[model samples]
Target chain A: MKIRVLVSLKPGVLDPQGRAVHHALEGLGFKGVDDVRIGRTVELDVADETSDEALTEMCEKLLANTVIENYKIEKLG
Target chain B: MAFRSAVITFPGSNCDRDMAVALEQVSGTAPLRVWHGDAELPEGLDFIALPGGFSYGDYLRSGAMAANSPIMREVIRAADRGVPVLGVCNGFQVLTEARLLPGALMRNASQHFICRTVGLKVENAQSLFTQGYDAGQKIQIPVAHHDGNYFADEETLDRLEGDGRVAFRYTENCNGSRRDIAGVLNKSGNVLGMMPHPERAVDAAHGGTDGIALFEGAMKALASA
Candidate 1:
């Protein structure tokens, strides 16, 4: 089985990289860019018996820092 | 008993030697040098110092990758067993990412790297790390980092303050740390993570020796223990 891990900063945490991108968009003659945020995607391959709970645990323990980031696990066949 | 201090050096660690020098000057024994890939710290380590520098090239985030390194697993285990661990600068970021300490170091509100001597107020004088300073006393230490801004929710800040977990406060608010936190002690008081470089200020010839008292305090406290 293969899975994707999407990691994003928690809401209310400042995102400087995202803000810089937003500024660049505005500078390039773009308008009405309300906000922007960036995140990461990590793909992993595992055995068919890998449990959802175990995957979540893996994300919680090391894949994502719960202090300022949240992660979502998406599985694919 | 001789103090057995270990200084773990990750690639890009520029301050490891300074930390080792400070430990030897104060403890009279050279700190054991260990590499980042090492699977274990020397046994019976009385003190562990994680010095400043751009660990893992500050990729992804400062201290993020090193926090997941093999040596960090041993560092975390030592911390859990009540060993004293001190993380300064990039080391502070590692501690936060490793979850050995609370809160995360965000980019400075100004998004610029800051490097200079700054004023700090000792908050918790009773911790093993701060007993040399009086509560509310002000001292100067060198800080050189861009991502030292500390962030934690209000409730968490309140709990930290109420529990006396805050070890140092920026007298000038150099960064946007909530409550102006310059350094924090773990709940158990066995671990400390701070942005300022106390190790660099340990010798008088270095311009200021205010940092000497901090290392002395930890050494004294642990020596008597």
Candidate 2:
């Protein structure tokens, strides 16, 4: 099974990197961009029997820090 | 009896030696060096320290990888048993990642790696770690990190404050940490996670000795226990 995990800072958390990128876009004359929030994608290849619960556990245990970030697990195939 | 302390060193830890030296200088005994791969720590440890450094190259997140390493499990166990654990800089990140402490350390509001001496107000001097300093005393300590900005939900922050778990607060708000928190003690008051490098400031030759009191306080408290 192919799994993709998207991890992002929870809303209301200050994202300095995303803000810097947003500033850079404005500096380059890009307009109409309201905001930029950065996140990471973690692609994983697992055995066919990988369960949704296991994936969620992975995110909760290590893939994402629940205190500041939220994670979404998607099954690619 | 000599202070039985240990300093856990992860793959990229750079401040382990400094932490060890600081412990030895204050406790008159060298701290045992433990590797991240180790599953068990030495017995009867009086103190455990996680030093500052780019552990695991700061991959994924600062202190994230090292927090899940084998040794951290033992460190967490020790903390639960009331052993004093001090995590400095990167070590602080690991403590949060390990869930031994609350909150998360995010990128500095300035989005730059800050490296300098900053003023700190001892918020709770009753902690085993900060008892050497008077409550509300101002001291200078060195902070060096990229993701040192501390973040915790408002409710948690209030609880920490209400319980007097906040150990230190930045006098100048150097990292934009919520409530200016520079260090926090766990609910039991045995574990402390702080972004500032107290070990680095222990020697006057290093430009300050403000950090020595922290080590001395812990040793004193443990010895009398």
Best by TM-score: 2
Question: Model 2, range A1-46, lDDT digits (tens) per residue?
Answer: 8999999999999999999999999999999999899999999999
Per-candidate alpha-carbon RMSD to the true structure: 1.9, 0.6
Candidate 2 residue B129 Cα shift, in angstroms, is 0.4
What does candidate 1's lDDT look like per residue over A1-77, in tens digits?
99999999999988877888899999999999999998889899999999999999988877887888989999977
| Candidate 2, RMSD to the unseen true structure | 0.6
Instruction: Estimate, for each residue in B1-225, the C-alpha lDDT of model 2 and write its tens digit.
Output: 989999999999999999999999988899999999999999999999999999999999999999999999889999999999999999999999999999999999999889999999999999999999999999999999999999999999999999999999999999889999999999999999999999988888999999999999999999899
| Candidate 2 segments exceeding 4 Å error | none
Residue-by-residue lDDT tens digits, candidate 1, B131-196? 999999999999999999999888888999999999999998987788899999898999999999
* Residue B21, candidate 1: C-alpha displacement in angstroms: 0.9
Model 1 residue A53 CA deviation in Å: 2.8
